[model samples]
Target chain A: MREVFQQSLRDVQDRLVLIAELVEQAITEATTAFGSSDVGIAEKVIDRVEEIEILAAELDQLTIDILARQQPVASDLRLMVGALRMSASLERMADLAQHIAQLARYRYPESAIPAGLTKTFARMGALDVEMARKIVDLLRTQDPRLIAEVRDLDDDLDELHAKVFEKVLSDNLAETPANVVDSTLASRYHERFGDHAVGIARQIQYFISGSLD
Target chain B: MREVFQQSLRDVQDRLVLIAELVEQAITEATTAFGSSDVGIAEKVIDRVEEIEILAAELDQLTIDILARQQPVASDLRLMVGALRMSASLERMADLAQHIAQLARYRYPESAIPAGLTKTFARMGALDVEMARKIVDLLRTQDPRLIAEVRDLDDDLDELHAKVFEKVLSDNLAETPANVVDSTLASRYHERFGDHAVGIARQIQYFISGSLD
Candidate 1:
């Protein structure tokens, strides 16, 4: 029975890694689409949202089945709980990616990044993609070091998020209200993407260290 | 064993209702602070964030304890899963309220609601509070009717969300970039609050009906 439970856990971990890989792809394409205003790439990201959702639902079902059949406890039980949460965070990361892609799609002819703020947004996007990659690595390898790495990347993303607002509010930007609205939402989406990455990382930390902190 | 499990489930239900009540108060005060620029009320809302967080953490622990001890299955197991999800949504609702209140406090002497947006934000705030109240009622009574009601309120909130963007984008508003940013974020926060409420309602629906849809 213990060995069977371990196998179920391995299955859960494998699914989580697969979902993180998809999230990485989604954000990578999303950033590219947003940076260059590529509608075709944006559509591709949007198309995968349902796929991620379905996979997450399946994962939830699998975890619940494990709980029912194996009735895991202690660390094993925590692993199941962590799986459910990590799946939710990864699914949210996918949605944020889709939101970023939609921003690009909406402003097809016009760039989503306003003048003077393009470079800031590009850095933020790169940080998000990097964090997504680290998440995939952390899930695959369970490397505790990658957890802090993801959090440090989030700190940088937060700074860029603040910079976006600062530049937008400054009189020098000369952007339209539509530009302000789009930039605000877009910056927020990118920041939230980073946050969900941090959340997944923290969950992994909890699973490893056996502490909720 | 059955009776003890039922008691544990009731305890979980009661804690969820308690958290939901706190969330209702948080949004109510937050909206008031936002509309009137009451720093004191905003501060009150902000201070309650940790309280809600602690309560949610306690509830999660209790549910896990129940799961480990009782080993519930079938509908009982679904209820446990639903409880975890509902706790998360409720905690998120409280955070959104704190964010709204922070917006009010940030602008302090200046109102968070811009000149022409006062009425629209008021309506949105009222809808959010109403939805929060309905969530409490639904959790307490387990009446499926309240689920549909909460969803209908979300639809209205969604339209107002779009209208805020429409007015912000229109030439007639003539607002500052700061105003556009705050209003955009405020509207998004309100819309997300409603979305969380709908999420809780659906989880309850899933618990009662045995379907995830």
Candidate 2:
């Protein structure tokens, strides 16, 4: 019975890493779709999000089952709880990625994005990819430092977001109104995606340090 | 020692409700400020968010103490976990209210809301209030039905959000570019605020049913 519970635990951990990988792919595709105005890629990300949701629900059931049947104690309980928290964060990250894709598809027909705007978005995407990688690393290694690094990366995302805002407001007043709205919304979603990533990092920190800070 | 732990639990529960009330006030102020373009009310919400943060951290510590000292078993453990989860959702709700206020202040210098937008915003605000009330009632009563009611209210918020999206996208295209951007961001923030409220409702549901729908 102990072995069976341990196997389920191992399965949950493996599925978590898989979800992280899928999130990374979804975000990358969504960012590329935004940068290139590729509706097809954006549509793919939107379609794949259902798989993320299914994985999340299944993982939730697994955690609840482990808690109820195995009756995890002490550190084991913490790990199971952390897994549950991580799943919610991961699911939200997937949703944010799908949101970005929806916005990208919404704007694909209207205008050519300024090169500078594309560059800013590219920087944001890089930060997102870095954050996702660190989350996976934290899961694999259980390293606490990477969680702090994730918070630092979020600071970089905020700087990029501020730049996007200033550049759009200063330089794009004469552009067609739809173009401005689309670009601004895109930037805001990217910033929010970083925030959610940082949230996941915080959950990892709580798991490692047993502290919410 | 048991009595001490019970007292601490009650303290934490009281603080949670207080935070919820303040957050409700913040959302109310945010909605009114947005409709009236009242920067003062917006700033008030932003200022009070710090208090919510402090309460959130305090609640976190209290929960940890309850778990470590009381060593709650069975449904008691569930109650402790539920309080921690509830604090997290409420903290985020408070943060969202602050963000709405920030958006209001951000667009204050040139208040150029289009016609009919305020009514839609007002309706969103009503839905937000309803959602918050249902969540508070659930927390206070521990009644399972209120959780479902909260979910039902979230559906109404979703409908309002879709209507706002269509109205803003189709009607605001010919406005001055800055006005269009500001209004778009404002509407997006309001829509997201509704989503966060739904999140709170879901958390309440989890507390009652030990599952999320």
Candidate 3:
């Protein structure tokens, strides 16, 4: 019975990494779709969110079951609880990716962003993709240094996000309010995606170090 | 020992309601600050977010303790897990409110939104306040009608959010791009707050009925 519980716990951990991989794919494709104005790719990312959602829910149930049956204590309980939080954060990160894809889909045939800001949005999207992939690597490797690196990466995203505002508000911008709205929201989505990655990093840090900060 | 565990569970539930109340207050003040250009109120809301954060963290620790020590199962375990999710949703909602307040602060003295669209944004802010209040009432009452009502309220926010886009994109709009950016992002913040409230309502419903829908 103890072995069965341990196997289930390991299974949950494995599934979490798989969810992280799927999230990485979704954000990468979603951002790629953003740059290329590929409705097909964007649609694929949107479709993939359903799979992420399913995995998130199943992982949630697995965590709940382990908590109830194993009645884990101390570090084990903390790991289970942290797993629950991490699952929700990853699911939300996927939702943010979906939001990005939906923007690409909404402005199909035309790029979601104006001509001047495509490079900016693409940069933001690339950083988010890197951040997403790093989350997977962090989970697999459990490296502490990566947490600070992810934090620094999010700071970079914040800078890029501010620069986006700078570009949109610059005198040369001739885009419609509609374009401004789409680009700003999409930029916010990417920035938030970085924040969620950082959040997962903190959760892993806590899971290992038993510290919140 | 079981009785002691039940008491701790109840305490956690009580604290959860307290955190919800703080979230409601922040959104209320933050939106008020948004319209009035009241930097003081906005700053207060921003500072109060720290309190909400602390409460959320404490509540989380309490839930972990109950789960680890009590080994709660069935409905008790479900309630605790739901509480954890609700705490996160509420904290993010508070962060949204802070973002709203930060916008107000960022654009101090002058209104963040254009004069023409102020009414539309004010309406959206008012709806979010109502939705936040309704979340507390729903938790207290567990009335399914409240859920439908909250859903309807979110629909109302969505409409207002659309109208914000309409006003921004309308001809004869003379606001600076900076003003447009602030208004759009603030409007998005209020819209997301409603979504989080609805999420908590669904969590409550699930806690009661044990159904996802």
Give me the candidate number with maximum TM-score: 1
Question: What TM-score does each of the candidates earn?
Answer: 0.99, 0.83, 0.97
Question: Per-residue lDDT of B111-148 in model 1, one digit per residue for the tens?
Answer: 76779899999999999999999999999998999999
lDDT of 1 at A164: 92
Interface RMSD of 1: 0.6
Better of 1 and 3 by TM-score: 1
Docking class of 1: high
In candidate 3, what are the lDDT values of residues A1-213, reduced to their tens digit? 678777987898899899999999999999998889899999999998999999999999989999888898888888888889899989999999999999889888877798899788888988898888889888888998888888988999999999888889887878878788888999899998998899899999987788869
In model 1, residue pairs whose N, Cα or C atoms come closer than 3 Å (at least 3 residues apart or on different chains), thus clashing, are none
Count of residue pairs whose backbone atoms collide, per candidate: 0, 0, 0
The digit string of per-residue lDDT tens for model 2 on B55-158 reads: 99888767766665676666666667667767877888888788778877888865546665667777877777777766666556768777667667777777
i-RMSD values for every candidate model: 0.6, 3.7, 0.8
Candidate 1 lDDT: 0.93
Off by over 4 Å in 1: none
Comparing 1 with 2 on DockQ, the higher-scoring candidate is: 1
Report the C-alpha lDDT of model 1 over A134-199, residue by residue, as the tens digit. 999999998999998999999999999999989999999989998899899999999999999999
| Candidate number with the higher TM-score (1 or 2) | 1
Ranking by lDDT: 1, 3, 2
Question: Cα deviation of B55 in candidate 3 (Å)?
Answer: 0.4
